[model samples]
Target: MIEYCLTVLGFVLAIVGRMDNLRGFVVLPKRWIVERFFAHLMRSRRLVRDFERSTTSAEAMIYWSMTMLMTRRLARQPPRRG
Candidate 1:
């Protein structure tokens, strides 16, 4: 169902399966990146709850949250000496 929906929207969905043979606390490739991104989004108060009435509004909020996160990280970096 998910694959069909994404495919209709012109997206290619890649399923990242878990490694059953791995021991405790194993990080799957490309999965942690998604987890970390969601963790960052959770920091934003607006996103913590479903406040947006429309999907467009929610998407805009997510973009705004990511922008804020990136700008803050960039601000902390030292200036490059050219």
Candidate 2:
């Protein structure tokens, strides 16, 4: 039991050590991601304002809107006959 716990602890530490270090000033990840999502939302008039009465519904709507946009985009591609 002791050996197993030590091995697992070491493995966890090794994985943590290899993770990316955010040391420099840069555009925060959430801001960029949310901005792109909002851009997609702007394309839909219904998403322009908060129509959903609840936060959960608002989030669900965002996911639904993005998925719809992605499906339309994928559908627009012409298939190769070859």
**Candidate that scores best on TM-score:** 1
- Tell me the deviation in Å of residue 71 in model 2: 0.3
Candidate 2 residue-wise lDDT at 41: 90
35-67, model 2: which lDDT tens digit per residue? 887799988776888788999988888888889
Evaluate residue 66 in candidate 2 and report its C-alpha lDDT on the 0 to 100 scale.
87
lDDT of each: 0.91, 0.74
Give candidate 2 regions above 4 Å deviation.
Answer: 1-34, 79-82
- Show the lowest summed lDDT stretch of 10 residues, model 2: 10-19
Clashing pairs in 2: none
> RMSD (Cα, Å) of candidate 2?
9.7
Q: What TM-score, to 2 decimals, does candidate 2 have?
A: 0.49
Q: Which lDDT value does model 2 have at 27?
A: 59
